[model samples]
Target: MIRIAGLGLVAVLLAACSGQTETGGTAQAVGAAGPTGTATVPGVPAATVAFEGGDQLSPKDPIVVRASGGTLQAVTVTNPQTGNAVKGALSPDKTTWTSNDRLRYGATYQAVATAVNPAGAASEQRGEVRTIKPSGVATASLFQPSSGDFGVGLVLGLKFDHDITDKATVEKSFKVTSSPAQDGGWYWVGKREVHYRPKEYWKAGSTVKLETTTFGMPIGGGVYGGQDVSATYKVHDSWIAKADGKTHQMKAFHNGQLVKTAPISMGKTVDTPPRGPTPTFNGTHTVLSKVDHTIMDSCSYGVCEGDPGYYKAPENWDVRISNDGEYLHENLKTVGVQGSDNVSNGCLNMNTENAKWFFDNFNAGDVVEVTNSGGPQLSINNGHGDWAISWSAWQAGSALRG
Candidate 1:
């Protein structure tokens, strides 16, 4: 006898005297065929199961399961070897189940789904899916401010191991948060690098953190992500130096309060031979590095040893503000004309006393705004020039921008 369940009812199909055949041999029991190529008892209907992406699946895509002739009862996807189950969400109608997490690269997953018919009959189906293996893997690292204190103007930088073609997919994995929260967004410097900065300078004394769960992330060009990355840093007091080319003076401020004023000699207006113009770039600049004593050379800026404007000499208290060979350093040769004349070569030349003071107070990630410098605004590609862009324009750079 075989029994099947229905809506609060049970139907039994029994064979008459099936213990033996007329020849005294044992009789075989047979049933009807089910949709899954299996045998099912008579009067019971089999539920249909469908798996999205069938066999070869992309690691970046999600898995979906659907049922027909019945409502889905239960569904689970798991990695057989590791016994790790994929997270999924079931539709309210109980007809669909969708994966919530991304699949792993070159990994196999097993899906088991059960569906129940209106008559209360249940049927189950199991299937296997394997994510495509990529040719290469990509990773990322924090390129600036390694878990320490930085000025409010600090821009978080990240460098990717490979050129990421699917930037939106990669960017979506990143998470940035702060204690004293401020609005910020990311800007791609190039295919291999990205930077994050607030609409305005970060609030002083705020704590900022950057993280990305890139493992299993598809980075385009058959490249998958490897490991996750994260970094946390504290924002120090806001240190700003405002330089006025017309007045030949630089005013230093700490946390919105003016701290010091010093006479400085900016770039000369005349174009130096072999080196072209000597005017300093005008706009906001973020400090990249600080050197107590270093040799200053014109060759670094393309003015070679035999060039007319070429010179090599030691300088003290140098704070680098741009990749185009610009610094705030002590220059005793122009001390007499520091307040009256702009006679240096694209640098803010200050007296020894004032230069020492600036070096002691300012740090990397500090800000320097130059005005009336008689030069073009600094390009966003030079140093940490993120602040030079307007807030609206900066937000437009995001791949997910509305």
Candidate 2:
């Protein structure tokens, strides 16, 4: 006789039959083939399997799996080469399983899902996926004051397109070198931007170089995009002057040497402006920022006369003298009354050539002193030309302290 065993194939049969005489005693025929039959066994059912939609991911990302129409008995993920295993458990619905830990990058992983039905029939499903390595770190850009320009009063700025999770790794890849050593430091302006500046103005003749080796760095969460970049800049000769409205005369210096003397006109005591009790200038001031302009008679220092300071101007000769709106430029129309008479609006009227000569000679750090201007010395926050701040104060703003 044939018998079927539950869902899996297993065979068992009677060895033999004995033959005996008839009469009243009964015996089975040995070779009679009484009930020649074959045994049938059912095949194990296949378990339906699938992966969650987010299966494709970086090494630092998670993996999820789903199975259907069966009770999940065991779920495991393994690396075929190393036999390393990741343990996973079935969800309450018995159709889902997940691995919380992140997978290794650039690796292929296999998942074996085991399931059983109420009939105690066992089945298995297999799945495979490859985890990719994190993306390469992107390049950082040199920010502030574009290359190949003259009279750029800007800090050395660096900006990353992506947020930097690994600060040490990113920092290690950065380097700044100047021909003449500068007391400088990096300050984090934002997650993507950083600024570097010296405690004082750059040396008159210096070459600056910046480099970043950002490729392949794991910036954050295993996602990185950085490139190797380098830049070199030449520091030009320039002068930035500070003027106090309280001081009436302007002194010009070249490379720390007193060079020229020019009489200046300042805001009258009655109309003292408030840059700081007395108006002042700061940072590396430049000359001749622009030239030629129209003049508007407007209320200044709480005083606006219909015709008080109205003059159709020549080119706007900009000699950045103070943090406030003070300058030492040619005021040809008001030249006769500059020093002896504080007749004009708050500007030091100089001869045009003198103004041009001063502009041409002075670099970013050359000094111009203005007295009789009623204001405090320029503070740090005033302008890009904020050279007035003491060296100690400037050093305090560094991100990397040594």
Candidate 3:
């Protein structure tokens, strides 16, 4: 008689008439269509196997195992060549199993699963597959300001080394937080640079942190990210200056209260030839850098240093505001015109005493907003000139929608 199995063959027979002993003795053949395990319930998973299709696979597809008329008893997917089991979880009912880890590219994988019915009969499946080979991998570099007190006009920015076709994916991997909360938005200035600035100036003494997990991320063009990025900074003070070229005056404020007002000479608007339109930038600017002493030369502006109109003079108290050569420093030769008129290349000019006083009083990251000049407005890349971009226009450039 056949044993308890659905296959068209018997597992063993008692042979009650042929056998002479009281114990069972006869033997029978096992069915070829039975499960891989010895329990021999039915055919291999009966068409419900998750990987029934032939397995030349994508890198991201999950390896799965399922049962038709039974509960899953065992399932394990592994990279045979590496001997590493792919991590996965089984369903609560124990009827299904699937891989949860991201598989490595250009690797071969194998899976085996066994299921048993309520009647104790069992079935199983086994298969192997190979994943696609990659053509390229992407990478990028990150930049963040070192730990220091920044000007009130603080802007957090990032730079990538590659052309990212999937911008939203790249942006989603970053996180930004601040103490004393801030209302800020990130703007994608160009294809690769994203800048985040507050709607108003950052609150004084606030701490901000920016982070990104793009490293190892699977970017487009088969490129992976370079490394993780993170940085924290402090907002120092609220020293804001409104330098009005039209009024030939500058007013400095400390903590939102007026502290000092000085008559200043801004760049001229065709008030003199050769220096025509040397009118200072007419928008918001941040103090880029400072030099205790340096030679002020016209050669930097393309004028020959020794030319009749060009002068190379060693000046003191030079605080730069733009990469295009704008400084708020004493103009000894034109000190007479400073309070009286706008003369000198696009810079905020002050008398020797006043210039030295302001320079010594201000710190890095101070704001120098040159207004009332009929000149070109400051640009996004013009030395921390993030304030030059309007808030609305800036928000429109973000990968995240308004």
Candidate 4:
């Protein structure tokens, strides 16, 4: 059954009965009790209209005709007010016919169908329909990450304001591709949200494309797409830095090749008062943006400036990767402890030289994966955390993933 989510509908299902049989058209003889209690034959033509006379309809509903006899000869759906025909297509076998374009709401339409028998005879039928008026229009809202330069795991995210009941019609309208053309799929992350990603991590210097014809598409009884949207993302160099707190090491990869292995200090495993564990989160992330220098305040983490937990410093070469305030930056006065121990506040602390090298080479969108950090994995809603979920699990979120 087709589900209707929060759609205001007029209660008139669109099917009408055509009495018995007709001449000249291929029909089956259905045995029936005659008026005089004798057996009689009822004619039911192979071709018939899908809508009932004077029935209230929806713009998203299919305007169809069923042909079971020989083949579909002709079908015409037109607005009586404008005298323009609604374009439609016939199935290969000619057994079914359907409208190809969207119908208009609050408008009256007339549908006429004809099918030929094997004997060259024709069967004709016609029906009138009136579409329902919608209470509100739902539009698609795109939530793409940073547009400039990005890491290899960036995804194009989209969210809608309303629930969708028609998955096939709506999903088919999307067209996501790449300049070099990489295979990818859209996963439903929520009832109103979708995320698009390639089968593997995107290659460096590749361009991703996103297009949607969902505008004006009927998604439910009364809901239609509000507008069309498109975007292109530029993938920069592959700069993936993997940090492990337990091993106290950070490995940087460039274009699938190992580039550098720097001894680093990560967050501590113990939790402090007012602030939770200083450990870094474990999972995939992306470099959202970078800063040359910033004032690092201990009070931001609920610690007083003069307290034992409070320590103020001007941080250097900061690269933010998550909304939880984790960063890959330089930690002055801690170069000796970096290689041998974990002793910082949820950051990958590097020496000045290594931090300067990292700051010069990396940009927004570079993948930064952390592991064994003694913290929870980054969530899908986190900064560029779309790659944290498994592919099979991610695909399950889509409405059309069946």
Maximum-lDDT candidate = 1
- Tens-place lDDT per residue, model 1, 201-260, is 999999999998777766788788766788999989999999999999999999999989
Question: Mind giving the per-residue lDDT tens digits that candidate 3 earns over 213-311?
Answer: 775466677765555678888888799989988788888898999988877877778846544467888888888778878898888877885565676
310-400 per-residue lDDT for model 4 (tens digits):
7678999998888777888999777989988877888889999888888888787788889898888888776767788887876675556
TM-score of each model, paired residue for residue: 0.69, 0.48, 0.66, 0.62
Candidate 1: misplaced stretches above 4 Å?
1-132, 272-275
At residue 55, candidate 4 shows an lDDT of 48
Local distance difference test values of all predictions, in order: 0.80, 0.53, 0.70, 0.72
Angstrom error of the Cα, residue 187, model 2: value is 3.8
CA RMSD (A), model 4: 12.9
TM-score of candidate 4 relative to the true fold = 0.62
lDDT at 313 for candidate 4? 84
Worst 10 residues of 3 by lDDT: 12-21
lDDT of candidate 4 vs native? 0.72
Best by TM-score: 1
Off by over 4 Å in 3: 1-144, 306-308
Could you give the candidate ranking by lDDT, starting with the highest? 1, 4, 3, 2
lDDT of 2 by residue, 221-281 (tens): 6666444677777776644444444444556654556666665555444453332222333
Cα RMSDs, all models: 10.2, 17.5, 10.7, 12.9
Residue 231 of candidate 1: its Cα lDDT? 91
The true-structure Cα RMSD of candidate 2 reads: 17.5
lDDT of 2 at 290: 34
